[model samples]
Target: MQGKLYAIGTGPGASDLITVRAARLLDKLDVLYAPAGRKGGRSLALSIVQEYLGEAVQIKERHFPMTADATQKQQAWDAVAADIEQDVKQGKQVGFITLGDSMLFSTWVFLLERLSDKIDIDVIPGITSFSAIASQAQFPLCMEKQSLAVMSCTADADALRAALNSHECVVLMKVYGRFTQIRQLLEELDLLDHAILMANASMGSEICYPDLRLIESGEDLPYFSTILVNRTWALN
Candidate 1:
């Protein structure tokens, strides 16, 4: 009998937010592989799902570098995938947890690409940070006849501008690094008044900025920050 691999999304950051299916899978995992962003950093995803993990579950916490160097990232991904593949081949049920949805802007995507052909992979979806943010902020992402665009701060200026102009609402993910620039652009588009910024959504550190103008010019938000702009609604 061959072991199966599961890619579970642990949800935005809350433990209770985990799906029932994901919870059940967590309880049955023989080995849990958690990825940390830095060499010595703790796995935040593991923290979110630790309560559901079985007592006998083997925890394998590994570091995946967050950098622009493709060679380093490729090497780390290859090594990690190899380890997981080997474990699955040995008939040990393995699981990997990711934050938000596994398919969206996640490291799980790379793992899936490498291991899909080698093993039976099951992807268990979970709540996304933006979805939790909208709930916490009492935000309605869209309404009838209103289109929504989801983007990232890393996007080029033209694309960002186009999204803002074309969509009734725009969600900007990973906006911390380019907060100032994005904020300025929103101001230029006269959409700043319609926007809100949220950091660490659903987590204990969660903070919602109903008015983006309230943030100082040099202020830096957490890496988990996001911004939502709705031309149809003027945020406080």
Candidate 2:
């Protein structure tokens, strides 16, 4: 009997936010794989679901390098995929956990490409950080014919500007590193007052800046930080 691979999303940060559907699968997993960004690093995804995980489930933390080199990153994921493939082929119910939604800007997407054709797979979607942010702030993402755009801030300056100009609401992911540049673009478009900087959405340490101007223009934010730009709503 070939075992199946479960691709699960654990939601943003809070454990209670995890879907009941995803929570039910935790106890049935024989092996749970969690991703670490560097060697000896902790897995945030694992931590989020640790309380609900069954004690009998074997924990496997694999290092998924955070880098720009596509070849290097692929090699690492290839090794991880091989491990998962072997486990599933061995008839062990394997689970790979991802933070937030499984499909959005997730490493799980890359793994799916490699293992989808080889074995049985089940996907369980979880709430995204941006979705949590909107709910927590009581800020509607879009309404009354307003358009919404979700994009990574890692893109070049021109592309960033386009997203701001085009969308009624924009959820800027991975904004910590590009904080200054993103802020400048918002300022250029006169949307600085409409933007909110939030870090660790739904977590205990969550910080929100309803007024983006209060944040230092040159200061980088936490790694989990995101910027919500709502042009139609008065954020400040």
Candidate 3:
């Protein structure tokens, strides 16, 4: 019997946000794996579904280095992939859960690239934080023929400024530590009034602020935060 590897999307935070299909698949998982940070070896996704998983099911936390060092990051991902591969090769079904849509900017991307060729991979799509944020903020992304750009703000300030200047419905993912700089750019472009910042979207820990300046003056937002800019001028 060939085991399966499900790339499950937990959809932000709320357990209900998980897709019906994803939830069903999760219920059947023999083993659950999630990315763990350096300090606390707890998986956010695992915690969300902890109540649902059976006591007999095995849970694995693959510690992923939360740093900018490229070498360390690759090593960590590779190690996780190897661990997942070991389980799947033994004909044991496993679930690799992520915060948002697995195919999106989620860490599941790394797992997919590493394990797809070795096993049967099924990606269960779930509501992305950006989509949830937009909905919560009552901001429709685009109408007709309007494009949306999804990119990470983990790059330099210049790169982020370029993206903000170029894209209209830009969903800046991973704005964890760069909120200050991003807020400054938004204010300079007079977008502070219209922009919406949704932190920890879909999760039980969620916060939204309409004023970019207000968010700028506040504390650092979680990594799950996304910046939604409805460039009304771009629609013109």
Candidate 4:
């Protein structure tokens, strides 16, 4: 019999926020795949689900380099796919965990595209980082018919400006190294005060900045950081 593959979302840095479905799958899965930036780096996704898994479960930490090089990323994805394919072909239940929703800006997206034809796959959704941060910060994402746009901080400046001008709310993901640029744009648009910057949302070290200008210009942020801009609402 062919084994199944599960792409599970562990939620935004909070263990309790993980869905019951994802937790049950983690408990029973034979092999678990967690992503890390380096060989020995810690995986936030794995940390969320580690307590739910027992000694019988096998854990695999796969390295996914943080780079814009397409060739390097493809090579890494290929290797990970091969590893997962090997376990699946042997009829071993495999599970891959990602922070936030697996369908949203996840490494699982690439893996699924590569493995969809080779094995049966199931996806379990979890709360997204933006939603968790918004909830924790008491910031409303949208209201009535207001539209919301989510984009990466690496997006083109003009496009980002257009988005800010058009949408009532905008979420900029992966804002770690690009905070200064984003802050500049927000200030130019007179939307700086409308933005809320969050780092490690829902985690123990989570930090929220209602005033974007308060953050130092050259400060480094975590990979999990996000900036939520809501023109419809602003802090007093």
Candidate 5:
């Protein structure tokens, strides 16, 4: 029997937010893998779905560091992937859970790259955090002939600014720490009023506030935060 690997997205924050298909698969998975929190803490995804798992099923929590060092991140991811590979080799159907969509800014991406050659990998798409943000904020991403660009605010600020100017809609993911810097740039461009910041979208903690007028400079933000920029054309 060929073992199967699934990269599963748990959606924003709510257990019910997980897709029906993903939920079904989760119930059937023989082994589940999730990134661990600091010092053996349970992953948020695991906690959300813990009730659904059978006692017979196994859960593997892999702790990863929160660091910008490429070597550290790569090593941790590789170790996790190796562990997943070990489970698959033993003929177990493994489900790896991630917050938000598996493909969007997910640690699963690194695992996929590492294990693609050795395992039969399939990804189950879940509603991304941005989708929840848009729905909650009642945002229209883009319209006919207009383009939508989804990127990280952690990237070059100048490049992001250029994209906002060129695209009809810009969804900035990973905008947690750089909110103030990005907001300042937007303010200078007279675009702050047109943008919306979505924090902890679709979760119990979700907040959708228009304009950065209320957000403090360099305020510590959560990982679930995102910023949506509606180009002037979107005002039509």
Candidate 6:
């Protein structure tokens, strides 16, 4: 009798944004695995869902190093997968929580790839940060037949430029430290006025800048910061 593993999305930083399905599962799951940046760093996913969890629910934090080194990342994933495998083998239903949707720019991707063959896996989707941001900013991501492209802010300038030119709307995720560079490129392409910056979307302290020119260079932003660029759309 092998237990199951669920990859649950806890949604963007809000406690109320968690899906009904994810909330029910979080209440019933035997163990919850949360990803942390360092050994003892706080888990954003866990923080989002903590209010719904009971006292008896077991929570486990696994370190996922924020690095470009493939070997270090692989090692961390392998170790976490092994732990999850043991729990499943013992007939304990384990839940892994991720911020935003499980399939989109999530750490659950690596875990699922490593454990899919070895166990029964279920994925529960949740609201994305950008969607929440758009709502908060009163902006439309796309309308009619307009196309949208979602990419990382860390992507090379060429790729970012191409996305800006090709897509009617482009979403740049993880825009914390690279906001300046991204804004510069948008200016070069004459799309700065059409861009908006959102940080900590849906959470307390949420900030939105419809005008990117107001953001000074070299300013530090939260990890959840994002930028939405629309070539032919405006919030007005």
Best by lDDT: 1
Model 3 CA deviation exceeding 4 Å by range? 216-218, 233-236
lDDT at residue 224 of model 2 (Cα atoms): 95
Full ranking by lDDT: 1, 4, 2, 6, 5, 3
Question: Candidate 5 versus the native: TM-score?
Answer: 0.91
Candidate 1 lDDT: 0.91
- lDDT (10s digit) by residue, model 5, range 136-224: 88887888888888988878888888888898788888887677788888778777767888888876788877766887775677777
lDDT of 6 at 164: 92
Which lDDT tens digits does candidate 4 get at residues 1-236? 67999999989998999998888888888899988735576777888998889679998888888799999999999999999999988998899998899898887899999999988899999899999999999999999999999998788888899999999999999887888888999999999879999999999999988888888887887777899999989785
Q: How many clashes in each structure? A: 0, 0, 1, 0, 0, 0
Candidate 6, residues 1-236, lDDT tens digits: the string is 56999999988889999998888888888899998644575777888998888668898887788889999989999999999999999999899999899999887899888999999999999899889988888778888989999999888889989999999999999887788888889889988878898998998889888888887786777777899988787543
For candidate 2, report its TM-score.
0.95
RMSD of each: 1.2, 1.5, 2.7, 1.5, 2.2, 1.6
Give, for candidate 2, the lowest lDDT window spanning 10 residues: 35-44
TM-score to native of every candidate shown: 0.96, 0.95, 0.89, 0.94, 0.91, 0.95
Cα error, residue 223 of model 4, in Å, equals 2.9
Candidate 3's residue-wise lDDT over 28-126, tens digit each?
788988777446856778877776776678888777776889999999989989988999889988998887787877778877888878888888898
Colliding pairs, model 5: none
For 125-187, candidate 1 gives per-residue lDDT tens digits of 989888888889888789988899999889899999999999999999989779889999999
Reference-based lDDT, each prediction: 0.91, 0.88, 0.79, 0.89, 0.82, 0.87
**Candidate 1 wrong stretches, greater than 4 Å:** 37-39
User: Clashes in model 2: which pairs?
Assistant: none
